[model samples]
Target: MKGPALRGDLVTPSDARYERARVAYWAQFDEVRPSAVAYCETPADVAACLAFCQDAGIPAVPRSGGHSLGGYSTTDGLVVDVSRMSRVGVRRAGDGITAVVGAGARQVDSLAALWKEGVVVPGGMCPTVSAGGFVSGGGFGWLTRRYGMASDHVLAAQVVLADGRVVRCSESVEPDLFWALRGAGGGNFGVITEYEMRPRRVPTIVSFHLRWPWDAAQAVIAAWQRWIIDGPDDLGSAMSVTAVGGDPATVDVAGGWLGDPAALERHLDELVGDAGRRPEIRTVQEDSYLDTMMAAFGLTDTTAGQRQWTGQNPDAVIPRQHFAVDRSVLVDRPIPLTGIGEVLAAFEREPRPGQVRLLSFFALGGQVNRVPRTASAYVHRDAQFYLAFWVGLDRDLPDEGDRHAAQTWADDGFAVIDRYSGGEAYQNFIDPALGGWREAYYGENYSRLAEVKRTYDPHGFFRFAQSIG
Candidate 1:
């Protein structure tokens, strides 16, 4: 059979930009070489690429921000790149604010636009992560504790299915597809063209960071768990223990609160009182919600417009290129103090000379847990916190032994935490090493998601190693 004619720009191996286009955010997957990259500028272009790939019997994958940790966005056959279709704006629906975001729109672009309208949506902290996979896979961030996951705010979406069918789905239309799209909707169903999100009013936030020495790691973690268990919905926080290149470990708690500075101070005081000690350093600042986001992305030191929504210095962006491996688990309850010590011990293990290790705990619960388990495809609504074990290797490390050492360290750390984990994981993190990932990522929702997979993609055309069905 003859392949469908291409409508968008087809970048073959002979093209000058093919090499750069094939690279993902993580340097570890730089070896994946697609046969061709189709840059789609419209929904029709997406449908055309799907038709061509289906006719040619070629495996195809969609690429937006290209931040897939498992490299699911790149295939050996065809790649539909939607990074060129990025557009973000606010549309007025009656007296409400609706955010119109293209699938390729980056978090920085969307957040900056929404900030100008005095509204914000829950999104990942990374500036360049695309809304396509992030919202579909149930995104979370600083605002999650107060507002809920990013997927909860999605009002609708436009998708191009495997058979070249273009459709708009929401609660009122194609309800089953809408249910699956909320949480497990990575690239499993189709290529997302755009998203319609409901925005919430932005409030004056108190951003704070408290740091303690390596010796206080256990105490800080123990106190954090107790504090977040009963913390207010307006307070969102995360605790991180980081060790860089054989350096001593550093423990820090950082986050933003949606209320006044006084309320935030009292919360901090309670945390310190529980820990029975004072942090070595602490800083709190009351700023606009946009500035707090800017600080999280490491853009606070940049020029004025670059840190705010002034429509200037738009080109000042951060590039994330690192050889990293990360594994995560969701905990339904706080780990015992002894288990916390074991986790800290794993962090203390010496990595390679140029390797950095991080153990992070993202606070959950509050509004996040108010939703029922079966309310959406996301089954981890009962989880209290999300924990991640990450290790970064310097790209310049030439020794194969050093790379293996870094991997071993990361795996060992993950194993230590897995013992106390709630046996569930976040779909957005996408771990390739996980076994029985269907049950791990989606608990009771796995069977339903697989059924949805059959209904939409019976031929299993949109698939990766860990994709549904």
Candidate 2:
């Protein structure tokens, strides 16, 4: 509080960096009325807490590891809490290595501290995410189809602007706020402590998971959209249709892979070829690199402090049993095979018995499709993959027919996924009543990320829900 109050006015909020300004992880909207939370630890302590919240006008929220989910990293006013400035370094940039990290480093301790020095980047997949809002929204897990997203391995960023000024951008200092802080999606651009990345050298082996059923959600999501339009960008995968336990008709199909492990058992044997005889599989096989990231966090009897950024703040509730529940946002493409046969008959009628859940897909293109959707500031270069879905409501059924059975399977899965995926969405898995969100999160660099949010937040001091101005 006082000590962290950037420059003077050693006031109160009981100081000591506002007692570690707690709360994060799925931060329940404004965490029960927040107002006096401020904690930053350098980059001039976020330019003296953005000059003491612009001379005490008060309205802040930067939080790291606070894994945002529409709650824009939680707010209600003043909250800097840069997750106690955790660091993660790695040198040798010339032809391949560089890493500054810190922005509350945590995606599995910065990927097992850069794979025990072998190096790597393109992070995300829980490991308690928060490399500053997962590189401000262009996140990618499972080594991003071979090292790419995660703002495509950054390059530079030390930010801290909005009247506080602590520059150090890159591609040339302040190159339009380093191209809208790579994929411009974190609260409007400003306080970004550190991130310099450029690492590589992973894949000692990267086996992952799979849990299918509900008649293989449209043949494992249309064979993973034809295995990502002709897979092999080092193979990352996805196929979800969730609602486990209180299932509204179960369906799961998870995936992930990198290399070795006999090429991940021959790529899960061509990804469950012909979708036959493939069920009940849970192998956390490893080849090192920190025991394959401790088997992607499924560590025997897992409990990494019950995740969601320790400060405890999770809430995605809606249980009261079966009825109407609508939510849709689709962007489909030619791979719609009659909407995967009506999502295999509305997931086998209305499944529940032993619910299935697998929803997380990464693996679009190598080098993230040679990036080019405006280099960074993520414009989904014409997308290769990024899918999301979470629908589970059934307590005893009767809340208006569970919101009409979750909006009739979310309007039949966003109208067969927008007739072949193209409606463009993924602004960090959106959910602000699903508006266009700056054309599906910075696609077309949303006007040069709103002119780099008019140079480091021209008064938009890190806004959200359509951030870059």
Candidate 3:
């Protein structure tokens, strides 16, 4: 039987665009060639694509920025690529500004557009990550500690359901679905076309990057945790130890501060005192909100219009990952120095010849935890910080054996930190290998999410690996 007609363009296998269209952010899924890719341009386009997939008996997956760590953005079936729907607008809502953002809007574009209006949203640092997947998976970043997750600021959304009905959901309308969409994770419910978000207003920000010798990794990790755990909510920080190829590991701390430069310096001084070592490299600047965000991703030198994947725009500079193995844990309690040592030791082990290993800690709490776990579907309100371990292969030297070894290293490293994890993981990271993901991602809210899943997609049309059952 033939499928329903769609207004959007469809790229079939024979089309010249097929090869590029089928690729996701991570090259790991580069071989996942779908029957056709539907480049959705409107809600009607999304509805038509979903109906066609149903009529044709083919699985459909939504592709936004194509940044799914587990490669869930593309599939072997039909792909609803919404990258063409990128649009962002801001309007006054009482005393605040509401950002009307398209689901396919890239984080960099959205940030740049909103910054022009003197407002910002909590979003990831990845320049090319889309609003669709980011907000759906409970987005977090430099602004997260002060404001909250990106989903927390969502005022409303337009979703194209499985039945071809375009519904706008919010706190008052389709409240149950609204609850689930916040943190239930994307691609499980319906395809989001647009979002209405209340963005935070900020006039200035202090951005800083500090680094210490690899020998100070343990002190940095230990003191960083204590500093963030007891620090004010206005502060946001990410501390990481990274080793690329044969280079020695480097311990780095970087983030944005809402306060002035003097206060930020005092905070850094405290951190340095606690760690008992001054940073070997330090760069602090009082910059605009937009500059701080761009600096986070090393895109301060590029224009927002130029910070996309080269596949999307030839002039864009952001490059896609070849392959990666990522694992995460939500730490409610601080890991002792011994456990921290174990984490560092695990990270230093099995250093491959052509791999980049990274261990990151993103501070949680503040406004993120101020909300009750039951307030929304995002239930990890008690976490003090987020701990993640990942290994990426050199794009030039892709190897299946190296990939396997990287996964093994990630698993073992994750195991070390998992001992201190509060039995939860960041849904945004979305690990395919995570055991008990239903509980790890949603915690006490899984049952309610499953119920929402039944209500909206009882037939399991919108399903993927680790989707709500």
Candidate 4:
């Protein structure tokens, strides 16, 4: 039987737009040809698509920003894309500012909109990642240390259930569903249409970048870990060692600082003192909150309108990412110097020529840890840091052997970090190869999230490879 007519655009396989509409952020999923790509513009539009999927007995998957690392955003069935629904604004809420954002709003556009009102929310670094997936998986970024996860600021959300009902959930309205929506991960419950978030007011933001020699990777990792774990909450940072195109590996530490510029300089000096090596390159610039975020995203050369995923905007500057094998772990305690060395060595071993290999550590304590673990579905509260490793194959020469080599390297490097991890991983960076994902992603909160899943999506209509149920 034919489903109800949609209130939005639908690009079928026979349509001219299907080729562009079906692509995800990563090139790896480009081969996934969905039956149709529904550009949902409202809650009703989303409901219609879901109903159509159910009526036709075809699978449906939500795509916002299409940034799922595991490529869950695209499937062979139906792709319900919310990118066209994007809208963002800031308004006064009693004594605080509130951001009203469409679930499809990109992080860059949201940041720019809120900065105009002198307010901001914690969010992921990638500019094109949409709010729906990011917050649902517990978003974190440069402002996380000072403001906490993006989901922490959520005041309410509008969701379309599996049964075609549109409802708003918050602390007081559908509280159980609200709790699960915050961090149970996306695509498990229902489709999120909008998000109401509490925004933080900040005028000054200092962006800093420090690069050291490749040989200093271990020392820099150890010292940066200690610096962030001991530093004030005003600081947010991430350190990474990357080797692209078989070039010599390089170590870099970069992030934002909410405190005064002089204080941030002193903190950098302390980091250098601890690492016992002066960085070969250092840059510290104080800019407006929006500009600082733009710089962090490496969008300094592009205007706000151009900083988007390809095909989303004609003038978009960011290209789609290449095939990659990515994995992550949450560390409750800092890794000792020896462990850091071992991990660095693992990154350098059996290097795939022309493949991009990287290991990154994002500091996770401070305001994020101040909240109790059980306060929301995001259970990595006590973790001191979030560590991730990935191997990206060349976009032009993505050979079968390169993929195998990339996967092997990622698994070996991840194993090294897993020994020091707290058996927890970031739900946002979902890994298809991950074992015991339920426990690794949600920990003790899995049961609660499962219960909420049953209560809202009783028929299990909404599910993925590693859904809550």
Worst 10-residue lDDT window, candidate 1: 304-313
lDDT of all the models against the reference? 0.85, 0.62, 0.88, 0.88
For residue 313, model 3's alpha carbon misses the true position, in angstroms, by 3.9
Model 4 clashing-pair count: 0
lDDT of model 3 at position 20: 83
Worst 10 residues of 4 by lDDT: 1-10
lDDT of candidate 3 at residue 250, scale 0 to 100:
97
Model 3 misses residue 140 by how many Å? 0.6
lDDT of 4 by residue, 184-205 (tens): 8499999998899988887878
Off by over 4 Å in 1: 1-8, 301-317
Which portions of model 2 show Cα errors greater than 4 Å? 1-27, 36-49, 53-60, 63-72, 75-132, 136-138, 141-143, 153-158, 161-163, 171-190, 193-212, 215-231, 234-236, 244-274, 277-469
Per-prediction backbone clash count: 0, 34, 0, 0
Residue-by-residue lDDT tens digits, candidate 3, 246-279: 7999999998898988999999999999999999
User: Per-candidate TM vs. native?
Assistant: 0.95, 0.32, 0.97, 0.97
lDDT of 4: 0.88
Lowest lDDT 10-residue stretch of candidate 2: 316-325
A best-first ranking of the candidates according to their lDDT comes to: 3, 4, 1, 2
Error of 4 at 458 (Å): 0.8
